[model samples]
Target: MHHAMRQPLPKPTPANLRRFAETPVARKAINTIKDQIAGMRWRIQRRDGNAPAATSDVRIHILAANLDAPNPDDSFRSLTEQVIEDVLVGGWGAVEVQLTSDPQRPLLLWPVDGATIRIYAGWSGDAEEPRYAQVTPWGRHVDLRNDELVYVRLNPRSHTPFGLGRLEVAFETISWLLGAQDYAARLASNTVVQYALWLAEMPPASYDKVISWWQNEIEGTGKVPIIANLPAKPEVLRFGEGSDRDLRLEWQRFLIRIIANAFDLPPLLLGLEQDVNRSTAGPLLEEAFRTAVVPTARLYAEHITREILGRRLGWNDLEFVFEDLEIFDERAQAEIDEILLRNDVLLPDEVRLRRSLPALPGGWGGLTYTQRQMLIGGQRSATGDQ
Candidate 1:
């Protein structure tokens, strides 16, 4: 007789396993932070492009190919965008690379839930190596090697591999914001100008009758006007003034600015109206990208290059470089490049390469025309022009 086959159990839901740090307030703050950072452009380059080997030069192409298709479904750009967003929101994030059976092309990156993976560091006395222990939703434990994972952390605490996110530090501010919003909503909905009925000589038993009559007559329809019979005229009393509402709004904006400061973001970038003209706005925006976006992008690039590219592929010379943030005039760079070319400080081919143009034919492109003329003269000829 054949034995009955055992059915595999389903994996546990990630939401059930761990609580996320993203509250409604935190999510709003994180989204604002991400919107500013996601627009930055970046690329990977070789450390030494002038190296003598043919295959070594083509390594950039090979690396780009691997990054172009990180997994079956996601591209490197999309994966990086998601990873950055996750890390900013949660403090630390990771992606697991499942190596193929072939030795040539080993890594196949796949997005994994960071909450499921538990990191273990080897103690000083223990001979064991540091490893990642991933517990599946179905309660299966799988150990992973360091090279098999690409991890990114921001502002990590001492003695721990995991990072401490901005959400942890800004928790109190976010809660206050939430509470302020709730109070504003309640004020808007519940506080209204109410009419009080004042009677000259009404009995206690007649109070309920008068209230019921008033409700039926005044609250029934807006089109029809009510003429109530009372001993004295009704008095109008307002619950809150317009100035109080304005103060609440101002306080909320002040709190938002505080939150922006924690993330190192300028209130102007987040669409907060300030007393700034074009002159001041330009400098503030430049400072924002320099202090906030550039540093964060560098952190991401350095970690990925060292952990994934250096260790996994053994391509230590390769690195990820974010393109310079151009908040100033583009024509200024062109003018600077022209000055350098005229002085023979940079070769024509080198200048062309920087502008993404093809090199000129033969070795003539190596020297500028000024240098060529100077060499033809046989002696150093100077007439004000370099």
Candidate 2:
């Protein structure tokens, strides 16, 4: 049913105020179309032999999830999509893997016929017991890798939990794909249309499938992808002047706007509503931001856009400021200076608690669990138990 509540939002543009026979619109307000062209131009401008090409003989895919409370299943649709097209097919671009599930359900979307391989990499809370931490190919998977190999990350006395750790591992691999010079030149040289279309063509891959695709994409390529390790273990709630600080405040405001329109919900609830739009927290008044806060904000945004807004945005009255997109960083100094020197306001990335970890997975010999834990612990027993 076509519900007529709000008009679709104007396509995000640098300029929304069109000049009438009498009114003069500034160049910045209506430049979204041109901005896209410029961005595409930028991509083309950077194209070189070191970059890498989107086309590939062997394609791969990847996916991952993250959560406040550890859940075995976290929907990895977005991550997986990048894996198939970006890394496997496009052979370029960056992807983030998280273990956070949308509403406490498992993320089941990979291991298909065309892509049968599965490479599992995650944190299971314990390297020893499945009860403390278990990895399953049964919940919702094709088990394409067909190997019962599960990577377990034991929880330490002080830790953030296994879910986040898994996310890190997932991203490390994604970076390796983006940074590999074997295709770097081609990747850097890709046209904007190529990258955008590459992004659009990616299939919604499952977690298990991503691992396989990533592995195969790099196999026998001479240079092995690196899997960077998380110095120690995950630490939850390191509240202070953290990353995404500004983004969180703005996100909180966004949540409030959402709630003001919906049922009676506090800013915090809407802010942390990815899991339950129905409760409260303890130290909710901390001035600084939290890691969970950023992920939760992303979840809320995705859910609303994917589940609610889909394609039903009001473009007439609502003029989306293209500058709002966090990733769009191609701005002129004069423009940034004008907005900042006078406005004194910060941009999204500036305010958020974002931290870019070293790109790519650990170097070759990075280890499948069978390989990583080989000598660190003990010799392999007859029962296949370390």
Candidate 3:
């Protein structure tokens, strides 16, 4: 009975919790796969630029694939196990790994002295090949039964390419949503605030207040106030005479209100109110089409993720943390995915997929629950957590 006593799990932190909460964008597309990001803790270690890249006291490394490494199905698992057992665990070294297949340094790992392991295993349905797996610290977990699992090393610089790029590829539909030119355009009309409220699916009383305000002011003098700031050079203009700054401003506000209402109304099940006039509604519709609404879409995605992971998945063995982060980058690479940098996993409002990343070859970035299910069939209950 000689075994390393199981290491203590990393406790949740404000930082950690944020990491598990999937981004609005991530939430939308990740649905293609099972999701799991609540219970894990992540380590985002890096070298300070001021300090030298290499020093006796500071040796920074991230897990990624080395093209030359063994294939996961053939001999790499044993190779990694040997490294984990003979090299890492034996000497007590800090570890970080990237779990993916690649042509260079196919499997890159440095045995670390940490007490945890992070595994990454995600496969698009088309890629039925065995996943490449790597390990980091602590020990491995037998519970992770995804045959399509492998660990690849990810340097900070190569992050966007691997994670975001893959995310973009896998969630092509959702990705398209954010990239839509119309979705990214911006319009700010305080009057649109009213419509915004309505679109947000507010109660009829809320809409009534807006309607009342509109009727009270414009109903009398046929005048409305400027509700929001516009560019010094507004792209839109009023062709009719008497459309002064005052009138234009009113139009803009009213338009914004309408746009807001359009935004607020979603789920498409409850239905929406459509009795708006051209003078009041035209701008609203126009501005909406012009503005990229990606942010709003992102906001909605975040809310949905919160509900699905925190509420539905919470009851199951799944837990997720939403982490906000700067994009990770490295020079020489066109995009960040294959770079030799760290911050890749430090997602901008990312949800760490596991209770924590794993140290085994399979725990590179870890798989979302769907990936887990595809690889291995069990999932946490959806009715257990509050």
Note the Cα lDDT for every prediction shown: 0.63, 0.26, 0.29
Q: List the residue pairs that clash in candidate 1.
A: 12-137
| lDDT score for candidate 2 against the true structure | 0.26
Tell me the TM-score of each prediction against the true structure.
Answer: 0.75, 0.16, 0.17
Compare the candidates by lDDT and give the number of the best one: 1
Candidate 3 lDDT, 40-156, residue by residue in tens: 122212223111111111211211122113344423233333322211111111223333454233234333322232333453434344333334334454222222222222121
> Runs in model 2 with CA error above 4 Å?
1-79, 82-305, 308-338, 347-386
Ten-residue segment with the worst summed lDDT in candidate 3?
Answer: 32-41
Q: Which candidate's TM-score is highest?
A: 1
Cα error, residue 32 of model 2, in Å, equals 20
What overall lDDT, based on C-alpha atoms, would model 3 receive against the true structure?
Answer: 0.29
- Sorting all predicted structures by TM-score, with the top scorer first, yields 1, 3, 2
At residue 195, what lDDT does model 1 achieve?
41
**In candidate 3, which residue ranges exceed 4 Å CA deviation?**
1-25, 36-165, 168-176, 179-386
Higher-TM-score candidate of 1 and 3:
1
